[model samples]
Target chain A: MLSYLPIQLIPILPIKMNYRQAKTGKLLIDILPNKCDFCGCCVGVCPEDAIELKEAEIYIIDPRCTNCAKCIWSCPIEVIKFNKEGVLEK
Target chain B: MKEEYDIIVVGAGPAGSIAARYAAQNGAFVLVLEKDRDVGYPVRCGEAISREGLEAFIKPDKRWINAEITKFGFVAPNGKKVVINLGKVEGYMLERRIFDYELAKTASVAGAEILTRAYVNDLIKENGKVAGVKFEFRGEQKQIKCKIVIGADGVESRVGRWAGLETHIDFRDMESCFQVTASNVKCDQDALFFYFGKEVAPEGYFWVFPKGKGTANIGLGVSGGVGKKRSALSYLNNNLENFFPTANILTQVAGGVPSVVALEKMAAPGIMLVGDAARQVNPLSGGGISSGMIGASIAGRLAAQSIKNNDLNYINNYHKEWKKLRGKKHDFLDKIKDGLFNFTDEQFNNLIESMLKLPEKKRTVGRFFMIALKNKPSLLKEIAKVFVV
Candidate 1:
């Protein structure tokens, strides 16, 4: 038998990292107000017109979002983020 | 207590400011609310505008001009260059920050009450008509009532949407645009350069607009679907660095360009959408500064008239006039952009290749366009329609 570390230790061995890489599909759009500067770049960069800026606050429309993170790169502060299973990506 | 006004315009961009000025000039108690502390700070535009478009509304003022463009040029995928002198057409690279502020100043002088850092959060809908707005100012929520609300709130306008108008743009008609101001770049100080290639822009184009003697605004726009995998910044940067490796980026900007026909409905019982909110930008050029100002002037005059007549429905006349003024022309450009959007890199190359074979004098802008339509002869009929109707 190949020498194996204790199975109980597996849970504590950064196993969450594997779960993150396992996420191959599903797109998530997250706009954190703290990271946003109200530059309105995302409003202009969005291809689907999914992003809205009202009273300086930005919000994403669910049906129109399309998970296309072009808006993410549009942010100067890089506050807009796209994720696959909580893994932060542009 | 909610303040009352004859007309209230949301978002004091060019459209809002100009609308406010016009409304006040027409004897309306006009009020303008701006979410941004600075009127035109953090500009998210390429800032290039045509002279003809500018003259159609504003009397040319040097205070807002950054560059007086004399020539405009294009580079094809095959590395061919075509530059044209500004014959009858005039163009300028605007200093939008100063330009917008000056416009706002005029509005204020015309007796429009302008409040900056005032964010309009929600609409006070009354019996299916927009009657007033609740906004946040200095961290306090405030409300104001008005007879007419001009939605000059830009491409991502909520005022229009809140008034129950369809404000969505199709992905194909939207251009995800990114731009950067670079210092010490090699640029034609008086000419604008546009680069075309699938690998360069992918259903869009890259542009270099000179701001001054040595500084330039370089950017590109890519259509929505193809941009899903990459960023507009990446495409713009990669191409820019390839040309001017030593250029230092001074500022960066990203935004969307609405390149489509006007929305089906731009006015309701008491609300009217102007500028990009109404999809008034040129589909082929991704420009709306002049068009928005034109739309705002019409809206301002109409809003004042509606209030004076005690007929809130006067907003409809504004909508109708806007269609006749710019909407019809934009609709024609929409068809042209739709056709150009499908052109492959090879076709772009062919277009340049064919144009280069023409005699020097025959290679006019008008002639170049004619040859591009040679293969797609059917498009000529539509082109004629653009003029006939």
Candidate 2:
């Protein structure tokens, strides 16, 4: 039941906005916020050091993330995926 | 909660709790900070631990045990199964949520102050040495100063990086893993099962650790590099039906296992890293509960001694003591794991077939490893050092 609770109980001031909406034609990734359990596998597998798992939230450095898709598979729950909007725009 | 203490331990997992317990028992003022609202939640492990490894620290309590394990089963890619009866209870499938809370309770009973929902933001350094920590608790920013800082944070630890330790893990040295606690699952409650080969786990292994009669934790870990070609989830999803056809999923959790023996350095001036933060999990098995607690016990005791003697050198003893305890064996295990990474499915099938030929009583994990590594005499010799004891 604890895993089902949303982690973002406190409003986290967005440090870096996910650029999928603002910028297009570039590969970007997003996560299903509720599905993730904060396992940190994505953070450990990212070769570019693009993902960071804070206690309350996950941050993907948009510039550093290259749509490598490593994090996509590293995830156990398949919460992370390539942004559909970004892909369509491209 | 205090302005100053003898030691500030980050995280309240098994390692942190053990570290804090020992530190407090040794007469050091200790404070433990946990970012989660509770001590253990959102479990991220398969939760099987060897009985011998655990008894060395605390008595096994039924309150935290899910199942008593006595048999081990290994399934090759070709579907050959080799079952080894350990002859007695050898391990336990734990309820980690309760187990972790009990450990932290023991630490608290030993006089260590514990704060939940205390998110550590950064290390407070003075003149190039760790002196304390900056943390947020209950929506309030606070700083606590201490003589020594112990990093027991799990896989995503930043304390080591903040203290300038070379804690970066090569992707190959990490296991991208995920697990699901499912009900209506059928597995031997008294045995632990492992499935191997490329089709099963892709350079790692699939595990079914039964928690009770009809429930189990089923998971798989793939070499971090496999993410480039396929994800671990895909592999598990594809195979889960064949293994547990009636499984009704309950909860899903994903985590990384640092498949290395230990970091190059685990201690710096006024600081020590324990458990996953220091890569203390066994390389071959990816099991950390016992090893992490052992390392934490050493770190906790040493943190107290170093502060008592007013000597930072005592902290370095934790690294050396850990090597003597299990670090050396883990190093050899890492090498064996590297050899396993290249093993073809045919090899795994052959290995299991050979094990099946032996008398069931002789089909122990040691004998299986011997046959598996017969091709590499040097590695086999190194492994003999572990089993010979």
Cα RMSD of all models vs. native, in order, equals 5.1, 7.1
All models, DockQ values? 0.20, 0.31
Best by DockQ: 2
Q: Please state the error at residue B94 of candidate 2 in Å.
A: 0.6
How does each model score on TM-score? 0.86, 0.88
TM-score, chain A only, candidate 1, equals 0.61
Q: Candidate 2: global Cα-lDDT?
A: 0.85
lDDT of each: 0.78, 0.85
lDDT of 2 at B278: 89
Q: List the residue pairs that clash in candidate 2.
A: none
**Which lDDT tens digits does candidate 1 get at residues B101-174?**
88888899999988888888778888888888889889999899888888888866767766778876665567
Residue B118 lDDT in candidate 1: 87
For this target, which candidate reaches the highest TM-score against the unseen true structure?
A: 2
Docking class of 1: incorrect
Q: Give the per-residue lDDT digits (tens) of candidate 1, residues A11-46.
A: 786543422221224337778876565655466555
lDDT of 2 by residue, B1-389 (tens): 56799999999999999999999999899999998889888788999999998898788998989999999999999888988999999999999999999999999999999999888878999989999999988788899999999999888777877788877676667788878899998789999999998888987999999999699999999876786577777788888877877889999877789888798899998899999988999999999999999999999999998888988778988878998998888977887887788888988988999998998778999888778798566676766676665
